[model samples]
Target chain A: MLEAIILTVITAATPLLLAATGELVVEKSGVLNLGVEGMMVMGAVAGFAVTVSTGSPLLGIVGGAVAGVLTSLIFAFVTLTLVANQVASGLALTLFGLGLSGLMGESFVGQPGIKLQSLDIPGLTTLPFVGKILFGQDILVYLSFAAVFGVAWFLNRTRAGLILRAVGDNHASAHALGYSVIGVRYVAVMFGGAMAGLGGAYLSVAYTPLWVENMTAGRGWIALALVVFASWMPWRAAIGAYLFGAVTVLQFHAQALGIGFPSQFLAMLPYLATVIVLVAISGNRRATLFNTPSSLGKSFVPDR
Target chain B: MMRLELVKRAEKSRLMSVLSPVFAVALTVVFAGIVFAAQGHNPLSGIWYFFLEPVTSLWGVEQLITKATPLIIIALGLSVCYLSNNWNIGAEGQLTIGAIVGSIPPILFPDFVNPLVLPLMLLMAMAGGALFALIPAKLKTSFGTNEILTSLMLVYCSNLFLDWMVRGPWRSPQGYNFPITIDFHEWAVLNAVDVGGIYLNLSAPIALVLVVILAVVMRSTLKGFEIRVLGQSPRAGSFAGFSNRRMTAFAFALSGALAGLAGMMVVMSEIGKLQPVISPGYGFTAIIVAFLGRLNPVGILIAGLVIASSYLGGEAIQTSLQMSSKLATVIQGVLLFFVLAADTLILYKVRLVTGREGEGARA
Candidate 1:
């Protein structure tokens, strides 16, 4: 029972971790993409549609990433090129993605989805508790770990990562250094979109194995808060994602135990926890300021 | 030789600012026409139906106003927040709570029918929404938390809370297991007025009056000037002795009250009782309406009408053309994208400059 609970928590956390990790990079690069929900829904639809058409979950995931990248490119064009308000444009992107995905996925409703199978190890399969909790998880969970490692290394160790952080830290100063601020932002935003898409794909292809309109629900929004909850750190974001995942799964588990609370109140647990955690994280000024991207959400337009 | 370039203006153009929305609307028609064509429909007629069919008839126009009423009220409040640079994206949640809280009067006291009853219900709604909105505002002002995140997170909480209430505690005793409430008493309802050949409500006129009053106040009042000043430069606002903290609370409370009022109107006039949802994305859509109207009261009034038509038209097109109603959201999203992109024109101009095209032709 313990292992099963841990496994459910891990599954719940994977998508949030994936999406929040990508957004952490984007925020660190001085851009805030609020369309994670939109990109995610689009990714969900694209992955499901591709899987239904070709019977390959792998291609569906790739399709999901491509769809996300494309959607983010629209945002990048408006915000980065046209220098529109980032918040407004991001909101618009989300509304657009939700609508577009709904229209696209109308035909895919109730269709059985192709699930991404987990790795099957011979001896570990029969091992008491730890086997299924760690080894038996699907490919996406493993990819989430790899994403955290890669993003941590890229943001901290690489010269390129340092440059990206510098741009996010001070766009004006970075522009003065002759680094391509817009170029770097475009890349970062697309990466955020792709990861959000992959997260969405994970939802349809693995988590639920079905396509429902707005399948990502408010997970996209939660991922946005998680970036702040993690204080913009990659590894911390992983911990925060799992922590939230635990809260999400705990509510369902509690209900199963006949805790006597109405299920509706139980369903509200994740969102309430998000608000409380956001308040706590945001309460510390100096610490938040230290990790916050100085140029986060501010538009960057290079002088002609 | 020709290439496209954008040049920032020395000062924002008054003419461009006014024309930008018109230009955006025109651009949306053109784009939407292409979308219609892609969907295998006649582009021209589709555009016409998409934009105009909703308001062509008296009933349709009334429907437009019905849809626009809540949007205008909510956006009216949101304008204050946006102008003061406070991002309160949880108006949807605020509306839900307003409906939830306001329902208590009708549910618990279904027998109360007095002249003051309707007014009291609405007042409770304002209190509910304002109080809910203050959670984020208080956190933002006191703890330095990001209001945008806090507010949005609360939206999810409100959605679930409403779901819980209607599904459990507040469910109508005779609702037959459906997650809904008992029908509101006559005193708790906002009666619709039949003006000539159409059905209209008291909400429209009240919303219109509020918009006008707000417009005048925002233009002439000292507080309005303070809000604008604070929005443009918080430093100058501090120098002017207008506290940012106070402004934050004021802006949030004001908006929340308005959003709550909008919710009450929706419940009283439209739904007639508390249910799982009273406003269908009215809170979120009002954000778009607020921006589309340039965050001005009069502007919001006009933007509200335009957006309201889209909602009606989406339903019309869905049934007529056999397409998904989600097209309305697509239209809204596209219009907003263009509007945001076009709004930059108010501050800048696109110039077609000389390039190497002629040289390439000569070669």
Candidate 2:
């Protein structure tokens, strides 16, 4: 039972972790893409559709990432090229993604999905609890951890990472230094979209193994909140994701145990916890100011 | 290779300001045709059924007004929030709470048939919405929390709370296991007014009156000036002694109250009783309406009708063309994208230049 519970928690946390990690990079590069939810839903539908057509979960994952990139490209064009409001454009992307995905995935609804199989090794299969807990997860679970470490290293260790941070912290100064602020931001935004797409793909291909309208069910927003809760740190975001995942899983367990509270109220725990965590993290003005990218959410137009 | 570049205009284009929304609607129509064509349907008939057919008949027109009433009311309130730079994205949650609170008079006191019951319900709903909205406002003002996330999180909570209400505590005793409440008394309802062989819901005229009032307030009131000032430049507003904290609270509360009023109107006039669900994402749809209307009261009024027609048209396509009504949602999303993209043209001119020439200019 303990191992099973832990496994479920890992599964729940993987998507949030994946999505938040990508958003962390985007924010670090001084861009706020609010269309993670939209990109993710599009990924879910595209991934599912591709998987159904080809009978390969791997292709579905790739299809999801491509769909996410395509959707995010629209956001990149409007916000970067046209210099539109990031917040409004992000919102539009989400609304559009949800609607478009619903229309595209209409035929796929209720169709049995192809679940991504878990990793298995001859020696690892017979090992103890830690082996299964650590190595038994599907490919995405392992990739999620790798993504966090990869981002942390990329943002902190690489010379290119420094330029990305420079642009996010002060785009004008970065521009003066002759770095392509828009170029760096475009890459970051697309990366974020790809990660969000993978997260959504994980839902349909691994977690539930089905396509449903808005199956993301505010998870995208929660991933956004996770970024803030982590104070924009990659590792901290992993921790936050796991904590939320635990809360999500525990709520289901509580319902199974028939804890006197209504299931609906129990379901509210994750969202309510998000609110409390946001207040706690943002309560200290100095801390928030110190961590936030100086140019976050502000639109920049390069003047020639 | 060729590239597209934007050159900032010395002055904002007055002509484009008025023409952008029109351009956006046209762009959306073009996109709708593409979407229809992709779906193996005739683009022309789909566009006609989706946009034009609804308003061509009296019944369709009445449905449009009925749908527009809540959207206009909610969007008007949201205009105050957006104008003040407070991102209150959880109007849906506020509406849910508003409907729940507003239904108290009808659900709890089923025997109260007095006309006063309706007014009391309306007042309670506004208060409830205002108070619910103040949660994010208070958090922002006191703790410097991100109102966007907090407000949105509350939406999920409020929705779940409403679900629990009808299922657990407030489930109608005589509702035969349905997650609904008893039918409201006639005095508790907002009846449709028969005007010259055409029936209009009282909420329609109420919404129109609100448009005129808000237009005047936003145009002439000192409060309106303060909101605009704060949104444009917080530093300047602060120097002018307009407290950011106070403005945040005021904007949130006002919008909340209006959303609450809209929620009450929805339940009172349309649903006639509390159910597990009362809205079809009206709160979120109002965000698009607010933007499409250019954040102006009169603009929002017209935008509301346009969006409302889309809702009716979505159903029309669903029935006639055998396409999912979600096509409307797609249209709405595309419309908003065009709106934001076109709004950029108001301040900049798009230039198409060869790659080498663009590079030379950059250097």
Stretches > 4 Å off in candidate 1: A121-130, B1-5, B351-363
Which pairs of residues clash in candidate 1, taking residues 3 or more apart in a chain or in different chains?
none
lDDT of 1 by residue, B1-363 (tens): 464456789999999889989988889889889988999999877877778877889989889999999999999999999999999988998888887777788898878778788888888989999999999999998888878878987887888888888888788999999989899888888888889988887899989899988988899999999999998999999999999998999899888888888988998888887777777899999988998899989889999999898888788878778767788888888889989999989887875656665334334
The sequence of per-residue lDDT tens digits that candidate 2 reaches over residues B1-363 is: 886788899999999999999999999999989988988999999999999998888888888988999999999999999999999989999999988998898888888789899889989999999999999999999999999889989999999999999988888889999998889999888898787656787788889999999998889998889999999999999999999999999989888888899999999888888887899999999999999999999999999999999999899998889888988999999999999999999999999999899889987
Q: Candidate 1: lDDT over CA atoms?
A: 0.88
Instruction: Kindly give the stretch of ten consecutive residues in candidate 1 chain B with the minimal lDDT sum.
Output: B354-363
Q: Residue A7 error for model 2, in Å?
A: 1.0
Which 10-residue window in model 2 chain B sums to the lowest lDDT?
B193-202
**What interface RMSD, in Å and to 1 decimal, does model 1 have?**
3.7
TM-score of chain B of each: 0.95, 0.98
Off by more than 4 A, model 2: none
How does model 2 score by TM-score?
A: 0.99
